[model samples]
Target: MKAGKLAALGAALLIGAAPAWAEAPSAAPGAARIADTATDEARLMALFRDDARREDALDPLALIYRGTAPDPAALRRLFTDSQLRAQRGSVIQSLALLRRIDRRRLGAERQISYDVFLAAKREEAEWLRPDSIALTAVRPFNHFGGLHIEFPSLMAKDGAVKYEDSADYRTNLALIRAFPTVLDNAVARFRQGLASGVVESRLTTANMIAQIDALLAQSPEQSPFYSPVREFSAGIAASEQPALRAAYGAAIRDEVLPAYRRLRAFLNDEYLPAAREQVGIAAMKGGPGLYRRYAGRQTTLPVEPEVIHQLGLAEVARIQTGMDQVKRELGYGGTLKSFFDVIRTDPRYHPKTREELARGFAEAARQVDALVPQYFSRLPKTRLAIEPYPAYREKFEAGGSYNQGAPDGSRPGVFFYNTFDLPSRFLTGITTLYLHEGAPGHHFQISLAQEDASLPDFQRFGGNNAYVEGWALYAETLGYPMGFYKDPLQHWGTLDDEMLRAMRLVVDTGLHAKGWSREQAIDYMLANSGMGKSDATAEVERYIAWPGQALSYKIGALTIQRLRKKAETALGPRFDIRAFHDQVLGSGALPLPILEAKIDRWIAARKAG
Candidate 1:
């Protein structure tokens, strides 16, 4: 999973906008027509910049995440319904302007931008429909990607927000004071969900309640929100420190903690009883259609749930064969199912301490870094850091996740590992997990795009799940050529990780589309791979909380792999691995179809040369 405010911004862009070269062309000959085309392209570029500025103004957090300062008033309005309506209206207007542009007038690069921007607006329009918002806006959050989980991290010292000066501290203090409104609004939305029968699942409701309980347990001084003021930056005068600390503590005690308590009471007393026992969204009112929309939006393709389910099954079977081969090589004397049990229960494969786990990942990073230049021609300027999830969050988080750094390299990207259940954490997965979440994965893909000033902001900062997660998943395969998988244990780990993505294809579709119980999904995962029971349960609940998202991993990786094979087969010895990689990452994240089309064009250009 990708964490942080910037990741949310990327998803918002994917889920959400555009502009005009809206005038009709003149009926002039030769030079006059060429001038019209150039004018249209120039106008379109201006429109892109203008729309991006409006978006930043609408959500000041976008600016903060990109290392730019934002108006403090805009920050206070971040999560309100009025803001949501304004964003929806913006999408509608942008799409209308985009439709007026003449696609034939643009050159190749502009044409690609035109297509991506149009597709994003059209998808956002579908999601913003009244019927769609009825199902989604009412259930504003879940345990997985909820603001309740992400907001604290965003406000922390290591998070996206800056603390360079006293003014910056003052801005952060104002943001913290405004957090209560966001929490109260969530309570209002949950009530709406209850009334409309679009409520969250009981499992998710329970998890969220537990999370809030953890937050409320902390005193004002210990709160993550107070972290910024704990150590003042050099820019703050000695005279101002005492008052700033007192004000922050008062905000947490008087406002933040009380709001959390109120939200907690509502969930435990009112919402939990109302939350559905059935985990899948298919069980809710208008759920099936909502699931279909989520599936389409997430994958960027019109695909049937049953077809994806079938594809997942085939991939799982193919991967299990490889698992069986690894089992034989390890001299295991039992069936694959029994082998899974041994791997899960074996103490040697599990880390004894958090430090041990961190060391393993750090070593993996060192090894992968040494070999990176052999695989790719370009690298990111933004640095990557490894850290464990905060204590309050580790219990519910996945095995690992990446949060992007500032666009200007002011902050380094962080790879957060889970150390809550140390015994349940597998040391075998360190290399593969680091490859997927850290270097050459999210860290490289996101940082490289943000560093390039030439691309439009939409291409630089906006992306869909299919391309973003898919590229990370594809990065895992690079382990083979890099030789980390040559060690049989590491090879087994890679197979297990691949199995996780393959199983997501089956398990996610099964839970949402086929009405599989949460337990059923967990049991299937345990039976198929070496994952621990705790990890497996977390994975199933994640799918239940956010449907259709898991399907992107394998769906995306398979597409990229197929395209690479096509390039290799066509070019024969002329194909350069580094050049192919650069082509893929060059334009940032794109919808699957758009990426495929772009790669095909590159192939033709290379062959012609």
Candidate 2:
């Protein structure tokens, strides 16, 4: 739903930094190491490890991102322009080194790694260009995608940043102290965007203003950023607690809150006024090219926006027909549009209270967990916890989302379901939502990759939208095999959710590439699916905020589903479901082409066996 780069920015803005670049690694694959002396396997592994370490070193906030201790300089450095260039230079160098590897000498498994690394390098190479960086660099933060929204989650008491001891509190205090600089930089970036005609949409700017206002409404102790102070670890002595609390209070009042106020004022006084009156990216300068670039990176396929738009239309129609069939089967007298209205309006379909919604997700989680063992063999050892979205973020967030844990399984993955608007949150979608965002969806794909020590960190932690989101979307279809979508209503829920993804393909391209107005896009979604106005609006705004991202869900899911069909057709009875899954998830998050090649090879081997 969001860009990974923004997560880094969230931490980057939190921590301090330097612009130093270290020398290249000692061993150069293929150029220096021969296959005779060392297997291609060992060389590639070393190459990958070196690449990861180099990246981690260059990123002072990498520790914050990976749930490790903050760097001593983390609080000192924001994403200074020089530092951004330094990071890009590292990627380019890594790309050059990676291409030096001899693919011919690599074994089949190593070949996959080679392809992934090469593809990543090439992709990163595209983003390094002045125009590419300028597209996002000028507009560094957005209401939906960047540090402004994500900072709370990173700073929350039970959030990604761990609070274990006094040192941890101090690190956070330093991050808090450093925020004004980041916000000032954000203002500067917004000014750059204004100068370059790359400003965000007016709608986006306004929403961001509201987001800031919400934060400002919270008292110092209640501020999401102040949570660490409120819940000081029992490990700390009571004698020291008051001082720490006061320090946190002072920082939030003087530093953090004031920074947010500055950001809010900038959004209101300058940025919002300059925001584009037009809704679509196509309306902005160089937006068409930028949208195309995003479409490529997001899907990791050579798909044109026109092709995506048409594909979306076809998918929308097909899914609608399926929904019609379900409606007919369910003996509904009304037309499909009427049924959609019913679906939206029915009191029974909507939850009565936030607790009911939370409990609903909890119950669905348990039921989905029961079905996981039969769907595929492996279950993530990393526990999945279902909870409501934090109060500050719920208004802007989707119905649900997943936050992955550390690879080592020391921390459990969290599935945050929005219980904000209880009545608008339909009960019908609960089961499918859990299946998509929880078990066999994000938790399984993300946690399994991290937990697999055999895989390199790149495979374990790194991900592309297609494989990651696609696998989760594909997981939604498993409801039938798992026997959960049996009730025609629940079945409709699956279709609605699936239709949401399908419609995303149409609506995303429509809004971003095809020049569909926000209202136009929202209307198209409401007509096509059972989603209420609120979710539809938020989603349309999301596509606007993060262009081409919505395409990945349906596009990726279809690719995986198509590959499954191919495997099932090729091996027939020999196509073991568990084995097929193992092959897919075992490789970590791969690009569609790489995943297709790997799955085809697996199918061939299975047939021979």
Candidate 3:
């Protein structure tokens, strides 16, 4: 039930540069075999280092444009068409590989090693924050360079990476320089309550401050961040890169720390205090216009907000009617609402342990895979595994999400479930979420695109909220009537999930655009759907923080449904679900307009044949 403007937060977290590296040959059998040899360890290290450098690389143009308004003419010259295309291309491959590794390592006994790898990453990031390398490369005045903050540390204990004391000083120095601008923008955005207020939930907002406070509270030497800087400095020393290392230290001490102090002071004094207690976008100024833009971006469609609002209202009506039909079919005379009530209170959906909850999802994955060939011809090269969310982050997640694999088969896709509160991991939504996050949803779409090496990297990896999420939401319905949910309870569960998305439209718009208070949104959810108080509250807060994003789920699902129906109507007897799926996924991900064009082309080709 995330309610924050996730789009803004999501974009903010992504920072780094790519170290230019010579291209490696394809992942042929020979190359893989060589990778496994003891001698190849050096090669692996070199590759990892190169990958590390690549992560921090920034577009020089983006750096230049920061703070200054974009000069369309000047900006045009700063980036070539090819460079932008290549950057997008690289994103696809990088994300694919990243997802691949997570999927493969999930649940293995040696999974601790993956933690070590991540720990190493934390350390490296710390080094890059304030070290000579970061200081020289990262423009202190710009947000694009230097380091980026992340959710939290996933690793709990000492691992392969030795912990050192002096890391935060170096990193904080680099990070703080940009803090003034970032915090100022956040504050300004919050102040401008137009198109939904930009305020976040006090709890989550507090968490943001806490994250910074934790760092600031630490001694420069004893900080979790400082360890990385010291090691990086030592590494450079051993390599006799004394000049580079010294230069990095001076930049961190001089330019970065002051900026951090400024942001910290602002959060404590201004932003956090003004944070709203309300969760949803409702009651905010001009919520409707904001939600409309959110809807447009989420769907990648130009559909008007009023039209979408009406569509959502209609869908809710339609779905409720269908639920009644289901009840009548089962000879249950009670109202459709009663059936929903019965299912919510039922114990059959409850799982006893974290493992069972996860296994339930894994089982669904298996079930979907078994049925894959029946409706879809193409499969992703990337494999997906179901895993519990990492402890640090799970507390905040209501639903599971897909962790895409690396494109080069260096990683596997992962579906991370929030197994913290078992009851909230409602059984009814399990199958739908699996399909949405795994199987023919995110897992299939993301990995398939990544696997397509010929596509531009950005096209594969680059995301449009509407296309990716829409495809997955659409996938939820593909197997719904195929007897996937044989049990009445399970069948109800499927509908419940569908209704949840449909409801998102009403509540999302209601809160963000209609001036419905947070309490109003929560009550609406509780009354219309079987959402628990906790889940409902979290969700409402998420919507407030992130205006219009909630609308994407149902909107995307509906678009895909319409498209599939188009295919069905056009092809009739020749229609193949699997073929249709393959075609849809084969193009990787594109904006809805591009997706429509591609699909139309496919339809034409099939008709011609």
Best by TM-score: 1
RMSD of each: 5.5, 6.0, 14.7
Q: Mind giving the per-residue lDDT tens digits that candidate 1 earns over 1-609?
A: 211111222233333322222121332122232334446787577668766876888877667677665775676675567877877766755655564567898898888898888887777666667777788888889899788878888888778889988888888888888888888888888898888888999999999999998888888888999997888888889999999999999999999899999999999999999889999989989999888878877887776788788888888899999989988888897999998988988898899999999999999999988999988899999999999999999989899999999988989999999998887889889999999999889999999999988889999998988889989999999999898888888889999999999899899989998899999999999999999988998899999999999988887787788788889989999899999999889987988878877888999999999
lDDT of 2 at 460: 84
Q: Which candidate comes out best when scored by lDDT? A: 1
What are the runs in model 3 whose C-alpha is more than 4 Å off? 1-204, 207-265, 276-288, 325-333, 338-341
For candidate 2, which ten residues in a row score worst on lDDT?
5-14
Q: List the residue pairs that clash in candidate 1.
A: none
The runs of at least 3 residues in candidate 1 whose Cα sits more than 4 Å from the true structure, single-residue gaps closed, are 1-38
lDDT of 2 at 563: 79
On lDDT, the stronger of 2 and 3 is 2
Clashes of 2: 6
- Candidate 3 residue-wise lDDT, 351-441, digit = tens: 6677777777878878888888788777888767777865534555556777666566545777877777666657767788888889888
Candidate 3 TM-score, true structure as reference: 0.63
| Candidate 3 lowest-lDDT run of ten | 151-160
**TM-score for each model:** 0.93, 0.92, 0.63
Candidate 2 residue lDDT tens string, 1-609: 212121221122212211222223534333364323376667677778777876776665556657875554543445568657766766755654654567898888778888777777666656666777678888877878578777677777887777888888887777767777777788887888888888888998899899888888989888887888787788877887899899989988888888888889888998887888988888998999888878878987767787778877877888899899888877887899999898889898898988888888888887887767776788888988888887888889898999887666767899888877776788888888988889889999999988888887788888899889999999998989888878887899999999999888888888888778999999999999998888988888888889889989987888788778888888888878888899989888998878877887898788788
lDDT of all predictions: 0.84, 0.79, 0.54
Residue 143's C-alpha lDDT in candidate 2? 79
